[model samples]
Target: MFVRNILSAIIISVAPVSSVLAAGGDTPPIPSQDWSFSGPFGTYDKAALQRGYKIYREVCASCHSMKRVRFRNLEALGYNEDQIKAIAAEYSVEDGPNEDGDMFERAALPSDAFISPFPNDNAAKAANGGAFPPDLSLMTKARANGSNYVHALMTGYKDKLPHGVELSDGQYWNTYFTGNKIAMAPPLMDESISYEDGTIETLDQYAKDISHFLTWAADPYMEERKRTGFKVILFLLIFAGVMYGVKRRIWSNIH
Candidate 1:
């Protein structure tokens, strides 16, 4: 009976692994990246985050909306109040009901979240061949190995189609995307945008920078969380040591 129970447990554990492998058999492994904000002590690289923001602004902003992030949050990327305001003012956003109870368009403020490029979902789909682009605010947290997946998807476009694979109109081949077909065309190219900071402008670099930025967006308080965790661990260790000494004193007296 014990042997049968042990076999059943082993089979249960192995079944999930088999199902996972079967479900993702067609998907290629996402290559890992060495992000600055990866480990327990990891912190976001401000320069990379700024560059990533620029890439998103110039390239990805046409389709993707990062509605969870406000223009004021650019302060974390080292932007001052004036710079943030200037950035915010570049975009027009919809604002409230006047005395006439009608919505009005106005220049965006620092407090305003990044606005969607399209007014509504139907409009977005109409613009993109009936495919709605996903919002990017929490993309890093929404996917498994989110940073690596983002980097892979960005750089994984292929010019030539694989044998036995054909793409429909408005679809492109991506080596890393599931089922190997994606709606979005290649978004990044070498030297597409010049950098103020003199970083080389390449597709791979763009992917990395954007991945880093998105990760930071997904978890802006990672550094604070890690710091707090370290403090808690240190306090626990000290308390444990003190308790051990007190127990030793009590036992010593008893003995």
Candidate 2:
């Protein structure tokens, strides 16, 4: 009778705790995406990278900065020296003192790092309602799911909020964001930007493109690294086969 009463008490105590735990873990799982640069053999699609650059320049650049990336880095995306020079020249960069001790702004050079959108962090936060827009240079590498998370985040904004959830002012609902509320508004929409390459301008395409580009931004040497690794593996295999043949010939008379 004592054991039965204790068991009943334990069950009663744990049931509500389990229920609360289940209710607290209600955020939806992020869906995995098929990225061109996912696996060991994967390589970035050049056209997609270019499109992604366009999207970043036209839309995302206003809020985000690619501080670690420079204009010359665009060469990896197939931009020639002249093209890169022209593109860099389009933006003004801060330069120092021509014979004097004052700083001035000048046309950006290919060697220059990307110019930030805001003057400083505090200014950025003030402009965006106290949320500091993070630099995109290493954003993909910084996040857990990297490209998948970015793609999901861009596409996760929903028009309808789920039942029982209330959003505070200045907060928007995003299915993939923690707590389903984010400070960022829906960034992409259908037909938001016209692509010069005639690729269909859809939210998914933009998300995928930017994700791919950000992946490249995060690790620009990925293709070269993969190529080098493949070569090393091939060489090792050949070396092993040659050694095995040599061993067999040397041991043939003995065995």
- Residue 184 shift from truth in candidate 1, angstroms: 0.3
lDDT per residue for candidate 2 within 37-148, as digits (tens), equals 7788999999999999988998888888999999999998988999999999999988898788899989999999988899999988888888788999999999888898
**CA lDDT of every candidate:** 0.90, 0.88
User: Could you give candidate 1's per-residue lDDT for residues 172-241 as a string of tens digits?
Assistant: 8898887777889899988887899989999899999999999999999999999999999999999999
RMSD to the hidden true structure, all candidates: 5.2, 3.2
Error of 1 at 54 (Å): 0.4
Q: Which ten residues in a row have the lowest lDDT in candidate 2?
A: 20-29
| Regions of candidate 2 where Cα sits further than 4 Å from its true position | 1-26
